[model samples]
Structure formats: C-alpha cells, structure tokens
Target: MWPTVSPQSRSSPSADGAAILRLEQLTRTFAVGDQFVRALDGVDLQVAAGEYISLMGPSGSGKSTLLNILGLLDRPTSGEYWLAGEQTSTMSDDRLADTRQREIGFVFQFFHLIHRMTAVENVELPMMLAGVPPAERRARAREVLQRMGLEARINHRSSQLSGGERQRVAIARAVVMQPKILLADEPTGNLDSVSGGEVIRIVEALHEEGLTLIVVTHDQALGSRAHRRLLMRDGRIVQDVSG
Candidate 1:
C-alpha cells in the first residue's frame, strides 16, 4: 500500500491519494578526477501506486542516475529517498540489497541474460537467489514465461532466441520475483518497430495490473503513452505533464 502524506508536505498528492515514492531535494554528485560533477540536483518528485511514468531527456541529463538511485543500485550524495514512506538513503548495504530484491523489478535495454541458461532458467534466477524451493521456482518461472508469450522458447538458450525473444525473456526474469515497482531503462531500444510495439504492449499490461511503472526512453511515442511525462534537463526536472 502507498503512504498517505500531509498537505503540508512538499510532495503533491497523487491522484490515488497515496504516494508510493517521494524524493526530497534528491542530489547525487560524482568525482571526475580533480573535479566534481552533479548528476542529480535537488530533484523532488512523487509517484503514486500504479502510476505509469516516462522520463525523457537528452543524454547526460541524469535520467539513468535517477533511475539507478530509485532502484537502490546507487546511493545519493545527499537528500532523502522514500519508498512507501520509509526513508532509505541511510540503509545499510545488506538491508538495501534485500529491499531492492523484494520491492523493485528492472528491465534494461540490453537483455542481461546468462548466455548458457535457457529462458526458463533465466526467469528462475531471481527466485533462486531468494532461496525459493526448486519446485516452486520452476512453476513460477514457467508461468511468467508463458504469460510473456515465450512458452515455445522456454527451453531455448539466449543465443538461440531472436532480439525480441531475448527481451521478452528479460522481462519475464525481472517480474518473476513479483516486485511492486518496475523500472525499465530503454526496454525497447534494440528492437525493430514491430518487436518494440510488442514489448510496449506487455509493459503497459503490467502497468494496468497495478504495478508502479517508470520508464526512461527517448522514443516520443513510447513516452507519450505514459500517464505522466517528466522532462529533465541538467539534472533537474524541467517539465511534468499529467492527463
């Protein structure tokens, strides 16, 4: 469930009256040899449960940095990040890893599949890491792959699949853990239009099912499909549109 916020808080109320994510003056800086570079600068944003958000900007605009931070793969140099109303910036590494595995699902431009593993095996990887029973993992993996329309290719290795098939497999792997939030970074970047459309349809289906979905993409058509569109420049959100 999302957390209820007081009207006094800087974060605006979500349409659903609860916020799943809130960022308070979020900042992330990095060292570049003798100089420091700011990747994210005082970003304040809020996302409601089941909201479909698209982040768009030119390269180097901190889109990936923000996504990385939101996914708990990276830490902010300063500021607070709240997930379901819990501040997480100061969490220990072990706790953060645990939180990420249980709450966040990520899909990337490149399908990061283990080349030697079959599609079902790749989908089972997350559950395996979480120590689920082998029989349960196999059943859940088969279910997800079938839902992704990869039932025929379930036993095929990544090297034997087409680009689209590889991506579907990747998506299956990401969601097999059943996370609350799905963060997709260029999910359709490598596919042709037909393949890309299929991927988008699958992703939108997930959003419709009540997963808070955030996607970073340069494709205008894809971005426009989101419920809210956020434009970023120079590490800050320049525009936010919702309809």
Candidate 2:
C-alpha cells in the first residue's frame, strides 16, 4: 500500500468551482511531404479545476499533440484554448511563456534533470529562470526535495542517483513552482514496477491536494486510475467517461 501524504506538505487547493481549461474546435496539423496531417480534429474539451483525467489511445491517436497544446508547447492550427478563463490563442509569446511557466507543470517518462546539477540545483532551475532570488529558490527547492523523500540525496547529481531518485527530482522540479495544472505524459514509462508505483502514488497525492491532474498514457491500468477517462482516435476525443 502507498503511504498517505499530508495536505499541508503540498500546495493548497486552488479550485474555485470553475473550468480551468477549455478547448473549442481545436485542430493541429503538420505538413508531411505534400499533405497535411491532422493531429487534432475539431477537438473540444473542458477541464474543471482539480479534476483528475487520463487520456488513452493508440500511437497515431494525437494524445501527444493534444498534450503539447495543453502545455502551451504547441499551438492549435485553428480554434481557441482558454486557460483559467483567458483565451491563450491571442496572447503574445512572452505572455504565453509566462503563463505556461506559472500555470502548468509537466512530468515526462524520461527524467529530464541536468546530469551535472545536484538534485536541489535541478529543482531550482525553473525558479531561477523566473528570476527568483537565490535564497528563496534554494529554500523552495530544499523543501520540495525533502517532501519527495530525497533529503539525503539533495546534493547528489542526477548521474549519481538511481532511476527512481532521478525521476523524483524531476517531479520535485516540476511542482516547486506550484502550478495549477500537472500534465504527465507516460510518467512511469521508464521506471520499474516498484518505482513506478511510488511515482504514481506521489502524483495521486498531489491530485488529492487539488492540483488538476491530466495524464496521457497507453497503460490501461494506469489510465483507469483517473476519475475521468478519455479515449482518443484519429485526432478526436472518441469517448469521455466519468464515474
């Protein structure tokens, strides 16, 4: 069984009974040779704050494309993306970058920690980039790393840590900013069962604390854990189920 995490250890709930994300007639296309490939076909979605959702589909299903758009890493070829009640389509590049940094946290299958940086340093990068003072960012990094059960390894570089520890550090970095939404793409795809389970529990604990969680995965068991499940096919949301 997974250990329960105290709410006080994590960021406070930010849900205010509103939709945190909304997409209308969203479409993304890529030019392939002489043809346009539609990655997202008129997709429409509304995600309430604090909701836990899982997106599942086959390889060509546009899960990654949609995740990219939601993360603000990519823009839809057509349609509007409203985040926290603001239409992001018209935002300037700087504004979009700021919004992405402030409102979204992402965890990927591969731990993206810098090999030369210590756990704390890796966790501090985002805050540092955002012009946070050294003292404050260091304190925040240490706190989140401690919560990740990496206090002893905080000074260890990514190269010196195990896969699980590295991933934990990545997670610490992702959440240190206390983003409103956590977007995870195959978060456990690279870990062993034990480590993966630990990662899952950690994220679930964060969700319990009211951070909106959206995960994209091919694993049925993992995808089923969410309160809401979405199935995508041919760049469209074919099914949405809630229980």
Candidate 3:
C-alpha cells in the first residue's frame, strides 16, 4: 500500500501558492577506498510550483548529484525526498521509474538526443512510452516543436541541427509530457550567449505556464536569473539566497 500524505501537508505556501518539491536533510555519500566521500551534506530545499530556482557551484560541489536525485536518475544515500507531495525515498525502482516518466522533465548539457532519430521522433519518445497512440504522439510532437520554433526541423536528424536547434528540440521533448517539474543541468553550457539566452527564454516560458523549474549550472550569470539561488562547494551548499 502507498503511504498517505495528507492534503494539508501539500498546501504549504511560499508566495508562489503551492509547494512542488521538498528536500529534508538530504544527504548522499559514496565510498572511495577507505574514505567516505559526502556528495551532499544535509541539504534542505523547498521549491514551489511556478518557481524558477538555480544551483551554482564549483565542480564536484554535488550539483550534478542533486540534479540526478531530483530527476530520479540517482537516489540519496540518506535523507527524505518529497516530490509533488509523495515520498519518493522508499519507492521501489519500478515506482521511481514511473514517477520520473510521469512527473519530471530533464534537460542536460549534451542535449542527449539520439543522433539517428528525427526531431519529431525524439519529441514523441515520452508519449510513445506512456502508451499514447501514434496519432496523438504525432500531433503533440508537432505542436510542441512548432512552439519551440522547430516546426521546419521536424524531420531533420539531430546531426542535421545546430547546437541551439538541437537543444531546443531537447527542451521540446522534455516538456511534451507536461511534467510537474523541469530539471536542467547546465542547459546553456555548450551554447554561445545568443543560443544560451534562447534556451533561457524557452525555460522561462515554461515557468510562466506554471511548471516548477530548477537549473543546475556553474555559470553565475545564468544562476542569477533564477528567483532563488544556491551556491555550493565541495559537496555542501555554502550559501542560499533569494531575490
């Protein structure tokens, strides 16, 4: 049986109306030889729906680990994780897999598109997995691609697109499922300033549409754009501030 989280517990207000994610003393550790390396140290964070937050840090500061945990690609070694009002810390792999597919959108520095797949097919990947019909997938993929300014690139293979085009396609795919949260890791790391800003626009548009968004990057300029910023180093947050 699933554990119950009362509706009232889900109603915490953060000026944005509703809390979307909560991390309580979240910690992650890895063993290396005789040493135990702490990747995250007692991190506590709360992200509200429609909020845009950023994580900035030096390399090895646990930003990547935090992003992976949020995206369900990795689990914390210790601490509680509440996502969309559900406790995910104890969920089985199957449950966790389902949660990720249904609730989270992910963008990464590499774009991570299949080089051989056309833009539309990549955009339709999630819908296809959820058993959405081919016709619906096609319609949704086309709709989202058009919104991302990739209508004409629908049939182009990833290799045929420029870096910006590819990342835009990636963003289109990530949000096609209407995920409750979008997690981006260094979304603009590989693009030039112009291309970077374009990606930021796309993310901001999503935020405007009421999605909870978190960006993890090393770029201070990019992090500053978020309403809330967390600065980290050597696996722990050194500072957390909001504007």
lDDT of each: 0.89, 0.89, 0.86
Q: Which ten residues in a row have the lowest lDDT in candidate 1?
A: 1-10
- Candidate 3 stretches greater than 4 Å from native: 1-17
Residue 41 in candidate 2 has what lDDT?
99
Which 10 consecutive residues of model 2 have the lowest summed lDDT? 1-10
Identify the superior model by lDDT, candidate 2 or candidate 3. Answer: 2
TM-score of 2: 0.93
TM-scores for all candidates: the values are: 0.94, 0.93, 0.92
**Per-model tally of clashing residue pairs:** 0, 0, 0
Ranking by lDDT: 2, 1, 3
Task: Identify the runs in model 1 with alpha carbons over 4 angstroms from their true place.
Answer: 1-16
Q: Candidate 2: where are CA atoms >4 Å away?
A: 1-17
lDDT, candidate 3, 1-243, per-residue tens: 011223542333253456678889899999999999999998887777767889998889999999999899999998999998899987999999889988899999999999989999999999898999999889989999999998899999999999999999999899988887899999999999999999999898777666678999888888999888889887777888878
- Tell me how far candidate 3 lies from the true structure as C-alpha RMSD in angstroms: 4.8
